[model samples]
Target: MAIIRDRDLIKDWNDIPIDLIKSCIQEHQKSIPRLDLLENYYMGKHAILSRSMGSDTGLPNNKLIANHAKYITDIAVGYVAGDPVKYDGKQVDEILEVYKQGDIVSHDAELAKDLSIFGVGRELYFTTSNDSPIPKATAIDPRQIFLVVDDTVEYKSLFGVHYYPKRDLSNAVIGYSVNVYTEKYVIKYNVKDLNGQGYDVADRIPHYFDGVPVVEFWNNEEQQGDFEQQISLIDAYNLLMSDRLNDKEQLVDAILMLKGGISIGDDEEEAGRTIRMLKKYKVLELPADGDASWLIKNLNEADVEVLRNAIREDIHQFAMVPNLTDENFAANASGVAMKYKLLGLEQLAKNKERYFVQGLRERLKLFANVLRVKGRAVDVSDVTITMTRNLPANDLETAQMISTLSGSVSTETLITQLSFVDDPAKEMERLNAEKDVDMKRQQKAFGMPINQDVTVDAE
Candidate 1:
């Protein structure tokens, strides 16, 4: 394998022979496996570095030097000679070509800069010489694109710390290694103690070293899990609270509906049972008036009495009356009457006794209507209406008769008596005279129009 550095190589590359290009592609493919292996090693090393030692601290100079020396030995043994099965010159060349063309070596430079920022050299053993330009190679394409290879790379603390020796002459013992200590130092920090501290330790540590914090490496898997659990608990609590509030609202609505006169129970016992059921479901509470009040307020006694009378009438008709031909009469009279009787017989039925006040109220409404028709004043108070029964039967009968006669009285005689003369002038004169007489009477009653004599006519 040869390194192509000729100026004409760029132009010739465009027209490279098909066979050579094919050879290049095949060679590139073969080299792909080794390159992949190298990448994996590089990535593994980076991961170790990131997880253990801070990248901003200067590298352990001794460890780095030892690692580099080992790495070089491995490359030579693994690719150049030691084992033919493990080494292939053509594959190695292809890998190098890929790195050269892609200019991926710049990535190494970036890694070195980051490592210097991490304070990695504080404890590591390695050497850096200003005389030696970092052992680096470049392949330029004249097209402004170039590949760089950095071989003799050394880490430096961006924070100006030279904790580790420039070169480790002393043989230090590191992880069961003695002769020159050939391994990278991977630091492990305890993150458990930092939970709930608010401030990010990783972020703070970098600032102490005058470096930007790379929080991406902070371990937060456990914290994330705890956060999710807390959210779930809060959601559950909210759902339960909402359900309780909704139930209370429903109970209030039911109470209002009952007060508004919607009957939902048959009797005191039934109403009590219904209330109990609501309470059992945590939807209602027993009011101060108790269950009896709920029953009396909601049931209409007059309607129940009407239904009872209708039923009795139907039962009598069914038992005594002959064949009933009308379907409407049969259905409404018989069926409805039977239903009323059955309900009346039932101890738990809604009846007049359950809603006595409601019955009285309804009767008063009818009496008011009758009074209106008879041109009589309606007794607005409950006291007047309730005292109706206390009046003698004869007196009540007479009053009813008088009311009926008053309603039937003809208005024709009254209209005739009230009629006026046909002539408008005569009617106006009569009206004026009547008005004058009325005014004089009013003045006399009040001791004269005192201001009239004081008025003087205009000259």
Candidate 2:
């Protein structure tokens, strides 16, 4: 949850209330356990691994873990951010150049993954030095940074808190170093004690950006991770599969029962010798009316398989992430059919795009403000952010659609719709240049005027 405060409580950053900051820190501290749990799940440290089998009962209890959380998260992340998010508009090239310098594509991918894993992502935009005024942005761990907004209808972001543990020479965390980002400055504070009960100002550094540099991106309206709701289903699947394997192992090591055939001495050593001899000879001589049979638990393999399939299907279905290995996503499927199969994922992506776009717009605004301070004219309002789903497409089908709408739609529009085209404006410019070259060549060949169409008599 985001930290909220009254806007009028503090006149300025200099008069910031220390108690409120401490409270915010405390509130953030409360969320650490949950965030750590989600991170552990993503890293394959599931709750099942911590379970211990009972030593008293002689049964095979296997703690098998399937990292379905990671699988769902990675699929959602790749589907949304496998292709670099595109930014376009008037004077956006300069902003894009800044992004390129900062390697924003990789940063965006990282942020996307964070959103999938934690349901929230954060980014910080800043300028390095006066000599190099180009703005750079980086993805920040959501657990380390939080935006505090005004407690109003608009909920405008007042500032952001980025805190980390302060370490000495021995690498022991003595306290926390907190950086509070405001509209005009980054106010630094140091909490000397382990708990953030009290703090002292370290320094106040001015920043050129006109607003808070940090931006928060939500995965969905509820800010829930892709696999969060399906975690129970995943756990159930893991348990079922683990027990299935345990049953198989038990079957392989089934107990051999000899009703009345075998006779052994009362001593343990004598019984062991008799058992070894029987095993070595691979035969058992029984008395009359005696029988030998293996005592094994009868497992309903068909029922177990059905339950396994059901749980697996529920995990994927509830996660809203398609099982790529499913036969429904076969290579031979038509593009329309593929899209139908991905409709759930498409809906999920749309919700993600809604929030991710907001974050990108905020990032662009920061860049524009910073560039303006550096004496550059940049209008970031008109910028457009485009997100493409990373799914296989039928080029031939797309080509046919483009051909049919060649004259009806703008060439630039059609060009941008093609998956291969990265820059539609540049592509249009190249097309125009090629047309001019072809026109000049025809004029030289037939000795006709440049603007006139050449005519020839047919024999």
Instruction: Say which candidate scores most in lDDT.
Output: 2
Top TM-score hit = 2
| Tens digits of per-residue lDDT for model 2, 248-329 | 9999999888776466557999989988988899877888887888899999999999998999988888888988988756
Q: For model 2, what is the error of residue 446's alpha carbon versus the real structure, in angstroms, after optimal superposition?
A: 2.3
Q: Tell me the number of clashing residue pairs for each predicted model.
A: 24, 0
RMSD of each: 49.1, 2.8
In order, what lDDT does every prediction score? Answer: 0.29, 0.85
Please state the error at residue 233 of candidate 2 in Å: 0.4
- Residue range with the least summed lDDT across 10 consecutive positions in model 1: 210-219
Deviation (Å) of 387 in candidate 2: 0.9
- Which regions of candidate 1 deviate over 4 angstroms? 1-213, 216-219, 222-225, 256-459
